[model samples]
Target: MFNHPQAERKLEIQPNCIGDHVRRETVAAIEVSGDHAARSHIPKITALTLQCRGGYTLEAELGISPNGYAEPDYLGWEVKQYGVRDFVNYLAKSPVTLMTPEPTGGLYREQGVEAFLRRYGYPDKSGKPGRINFGGIYANGRDFHADTGLKLVLEGFDADKGKITNVDGQIALIDRDDVVAASWGFRGVIGHWNRKHAKAVYVPSLMRAPPPEYAYGARVELCEGTDVLLLLGALASGAIYYDPGMKMERADTPAPVTKRRSQFRVRHNDLTTLYQASVHENIDP
Candidate 1:
C-alpha cells in the first residue's frame, strides 16, 4: 500500500525517500478528485476526438503534459492508466504496452521501413487501398507466424542465468533463411525500459463518453526496482511479446506514408513479474 514504509524503500531512493513523496502526492491527487468524472485533457482540434482519453485525463489530474521524453512522467515515477470496467473489479481491458522502440538493426534498418514492409508485409486486412501492414503476435519460443513468416528470437539471453549475456544482443525477427528482418538491441530496449519503468504507478480507471470523460479508480498499483535482467527473463519465457502495428499507406506511390509501431506488451497479471516489489493501495479517503 502507498502508506507502507517498506514499499517506499523498495525503490532504494536514499536520504529523503523521494518515492514516498511521489506516492503521497499521487494518492492526494486521486483523493482530492473525489468521485467526479474528469473531462478530456486533449488539446481541442476542431471535430477531433481521441477514443483513448483515460490516460490523458488522469495525466491532466496529476498536472502531467504529454511529451516524447523517455523518462518517468511525474517526479521520477511513470504514471500509467489502465481501463477497467469497474474500479472495484479492476479488470484489465487490454494488455499493457511496455515500450515502442523501432528496430535499431536488421533489414528494417538497412533497407528502410518501406522495403521491409514490401518484403514481409501483407495486404491490409481491412481492404484499405494502397496499404500494406506488418502486423502479428510474435512471441518468444513460438514458431514462425503463418502470415509473416518470421519467428521471434532472443539473442544473447541465458534462460538459465536469467540475465542478458550480451549488451549488443537483440530481440529479433528472423525468416526461414535466418535473415534478420527486424530487431531491437539490448541497450535500446533496456535503456528505454529502465528510464521510464524503473519506478512506475499504474492507475485503473473507468471511462465513458457522451461528451467524453474518465473516472480514475481508488485502487492504484505502485511498482519499483525493475532491471534489464528481469525484462530479458520475461522476454525469453514468452511472457512479453512483440505486437507491432506497422503499416505503409499509399504503397504504390513514390513517396508513400509509413507508420512504425514496434511494441512490446504483457498481460496485466504478468506486470508484477518484472518488478522487485508491487503494492496495490486504496487511495480513497
Candidate 2:
C-alpha cells in the first residue's frame, strides 16, 4: 500500500490547495485499494476512488458534460490514467488531442462536408470508405504534403500583427482538386489551446491487469498560462506535429462524410517545457 505523509492531514481543501491536496488524497486512496481483478472498467475505478477519498462522483468517461462546467473531475482536477505497458521507462506513450474542428474555408467550406468527402474519402484499413487525415513534420517553404502534392506557404504568421497562418496561408485540408477542403484559422486553434491550459491539471496514472486490473496515480503535472505560448512555438518549430483522428461516416446520408479530429501532439519527454510543475514518484503499486 502507498503511504503519503499528507494523507493523514484530512485538511479541507481550498482553491489554492486543490492541486496538492487532490494529488495526495488520490495517491492514498489508490494505495489503500491495492490491486484487484480486472472486474471493472477504467471509469468505474476512477469513480470509486474519487468518491471514496474526494467525496465526489464523476462520469466514467474522460470528457466534460454538456451542462457541466470544466473542473478535471468533481474536485476540479483533471484525472488521466493510462496502461502501464504503454509507457517506456519514465515516458508515457499517449498522444494529446489538441483540436478537432472541421475546416473553415475554401472549397471544403463551400462544397460542404458531403462534397469534400466524395472527393477525398478513401478505403480505410478496414476497407471501409473513410477520410484519412494526414500531418507531418513541416518546415517553412517545405512540401509538408509531398504525397498529396500540397505545398506549405506561410501567410499570416506575423508576431507584431498577432496573427498566425499555416503552410497554405490557411489551416486546411486540401483535395486532389487543389481546393481547400476544410480549414482552421490560427486564432481559432490558439484560443482553444489557451482555454485548455487555463484549468489544466494532469493526473497521470499507471494501470496493470491480470485477473484484477489495478491502477495508481503516479504523478500530477500542472501547466501555467504562459506554457501555451511555448506550445505554440513548438508547433511552429515542428517539434510538435499534427495527428488527425478518423471517424466513420454515418450511413443515413446520401453522401456520407467521415469526420477527422485534428490534433497537435508531442512526445512525453517534451512535456517538461509545456508544463510548469510535475510531481512524480508519489505512488508505487
Candidate 3:
C-alpha cells in the first residue's frame, strides 16, 4: 500500500549492520516526502515504518510474536516511537500489564473476573456497564481500594522477599481477604524487566490528527536497558502513577473483561532518565 524506492533499495543491500541502516533509511523515507509526507490512516509509527520500508516485515516476519518473548525489532535493535506537539514536550508512556493469573490466593482472584465485574461494574460515560480498572499512585505503607470495595495496603518490598505486607501485615496479596484486588509481585515485575528488549532506538515523531497521520524521524534517541530499572525505581518513589486499562463490556460475553494492563506513566520531562543520547533535526517541506 506504500512505496519508498530509496528505503527499499537501501534495505535490499541488507548491510551486515542493519540497525544504523534502518535508522537512516527511516529518516530518509520521512524526509524526502514534502507536504505529501503525511500518511493518513496509519495510526502508529510501527505501521508507518513498515510502510516506508516497503519490504521489511514486522513482529511476525521478524519471528517475534506478541507477548511471546523479547527480541529486537530488527537486527538486534528495538525501535520505539512517540508523537509530540513539539520537540520540547514528549510524554513517554508504556503499558506494564503484568497483573495476570490475578493473585493466586486473594479473595478477588477467588471471585474471578466475572464475579468481580458483577460486583464493581459501573456505568461508563456511554452508560454501558463497564468493569472498573483500579489504579493509583503507590508508596510504601500506603493504602488503596479496588472498585469492589477491596482494600489494599503497600509495604516497602525487597527483591529477596518477593512479596509485600498487606493490611493484615502478612505477606501481601497472598492468603488475604481484604488485600488489593491485583498484585504485581517483585518476581512479576522483575520477570517483565528481564524479558524486555533493551538497547532501544527511540524515534520521536511530530503528529497531526483528523486523518490520524504522522511525520516521523524528527529525532532519535539511544537508550539503555538500565532505564527500565530507573522506571521501576520511579514507581517505588511514586513519580509514576498506575493507570490500568479496562476492557469494555460486551454483549457477546456473559461478563465484562478487564485488560489488566498495569500501565505506569511518567510526565514528559521525566523521560530524560530513560534516554542516554539524542539527535534532533528538522524535516524540510
Candidate 3: clashing pairs of residues: 97-262
Question: Model 1 over residues 76-95: C-alpha lDDT tens digits?
Answer: 78888887767557899998
Backbone clashes (count) for model 3: 1
Candidate 1 has its poorest 10 consecutive residues by lDDT at 1-10
lDDT of 3 by residue, 1-285 (tens): 123211121111111223352233332232223333223432323433442221122222223333434444545556545544455544433322222223433444677654544554444544554334434443333454443344333344432443343322211331135445555554555444444534455554444433344444333555443444454555555455454444445523665455543344555455455444334333332
Candidate 1's TM-score reads 0.83
Stretches off by above 4 angstroms in model 1 are: 1-48
lDDT of each: 0.76, 0.43, 0.40
Q: Comparing 2 and 3 by lDDT, which wins?
A: 2
Per candidate, the number of residue pairs that clash is: 0, 14, 1
Measured over all alpha carbons after superposition, the RMSD of each candidate to the real structure, in angstroms, is: 6.5, 8.0, 8.6
How should the candidates be ordered by TM-score, best one leading? 1, 2, 3
Each candidate structure's TM-score, on Cα atoms with residue i matched to residue i, is: 0.83, 0.58, 0.55
- TM-score: which is higher, 2 or 3? 2
Error of 1 at 23 (Å): 12
